[model samples]
Target: MTFTFKKAVRSESKLRLALEGISGSGKTYSALRLAKGLGGKIAVVDTERGSASLYSGLPGIPEFDVLELTDSFSPEVYVDAIHAAEEAGYNVIILDSITPEWSGKNGCLELADLYSKGNSLAGWKKVTPLHRKFLDTIVNSKCHIIATMRSKAAVSMVDGKVKKVQDKTEQRDGTEFEFTVVLSIDRDSHNAVASKDRTGLFKDPEVLTEETGKKLLSWLSGAATISPEIQAEAEKAAQLGVESIKNFMASLKESKPDQHALFSDAEKKRLYVVARKADINATQQGK
Candidate 1:
């Protein structure tokens, strides 16, 4: 294979941010505030039972759309919702408490347990791909993403005294590396400290607000360029035949009518073509 290189340059990009905190640390509100600052049509995938909705019409909080996930927390379910939101033209999407996707009922953990059937290692082997796909969906999404993760209080014994400390985030380990920014929020003051920041905007711990998002947006604005992954997907979709795309759309309309209804005609055609390409690739690999 031949190799080629080009001068590296920064381009305007979507945000992949994660907020980590215990309950009452104001992660949901903080996400909304940051989204407000980012300045776009926002959508929230609420896994916390309408918690994000409670903040609607509050001071400094802009109006936004919400899609509540009551029971199902599967990765595919989340992926479909994200696609729907992206098709609907949301500029930013808040995954309010991604914790449930990792640990809640019908989540990855439970799915692994069911798949493993008494073999833990074997179970994760089957489930890891699903989890990775979830991560990839987040990473490659065209819209900016703000995901909230729940953390527990860590306690340590210091000189025979139990001291409470901030716990690690509650999702899969190493999940922080996926985001451009990861903020750890204080429970009492709700001030956020950057555990990880690729942007270099937050140097000191401060209260998260709309300004924080605006700063991020300002930093993110640059010369626009298509990402290699998106470009590749588009190229693959272009290679697919119109008849195949139509067949996939017809199948989707029959099998997933509700999800099918979420897409516009153009989006439906594009999505079906891309999905068909993915299916063909998977079949080829299997063969």
Candidate 2:
């Protein structure tokens, strides 16, 4: 076999965003808001009961589907959920609280413990493959993946004075490294900081919202340039006729694929619905 080399090209890839925060840190609400910004059909792999659905009716929050994984947090279960979401045509899959799958009840750690009995070194062998599979699924999935992790305060006795310490996620050590962006949220303030970002999208702490999600998308798509005139016309056409809107989207994709990322799947869906209504009304009038 001969070794080959080629010029590096930009990879228009999906995102893997990890949000870590302690309980009451608004990680669930924030993640849903971000997912709304991601566009297309959004699905949540819910583990904390039905908590993901509670914010459904909030303003700016789009309606989304959910799959509850309350039975077990096994690694295989996570793999299954990723496949199911991909098969269902969801553009974004929010794995809310991946923490449980790693360390919570019935998770990988438990399985390792059961198999190893007392041998610490042997325990990892049982769990490593399971973790690798799940991680591979998250990294290689076609859809955008956002995972939330539960965090706990890291406390240590310093000079005999107990003080609140830095937050640590319940996931395996170095789990944050797998994600394209790692956001650490303050439990009380609800502020988020991009502790790690491959895209250089979020440099400082900010409140995570739909807009934040949009900004990240823009960066991911190379911040494509679209003239003001074309954008205005596209918006007008989208409002007036369904066929025109479809044509407009098609033209954008062909001419400026980068700018096409500007429109979210949710926005496109809403416009399509309006266009369909107009067509129906027009047909009735003609008849």
Highest lDDT among the candidates is held by which one?
2
In terms of lDDT, model 1 sits at 0.81
Candidate 1 segments exceeding 4 Å error: 1-4, 155-164, 222-287
Q: Model 1, range 106-211, lDDT digits (tens) per residue?
A: 8899999999989999999988898888899999999999999999888777679775557877899988889999999987678899899887666677778775
User: Residues 1-287, candidate 2, lDDT per residue (tens digit)?
Assistant: 99999864334678899998877888889998888777899989999999999988988788899998877999999999999999999999999989889987779889889878799669889888899899999999999999999888766676797744447679899888889999988765688887898876565567787766766677666673346877787778767789989998899778865566555445667778877888888889899
lDDT of 1 at 152: 88
Worst 10 residues of 1 by lDDT: 257-266
- lDDT (Cα atoms) of all candidates against the true structure: 0.81, 0.82
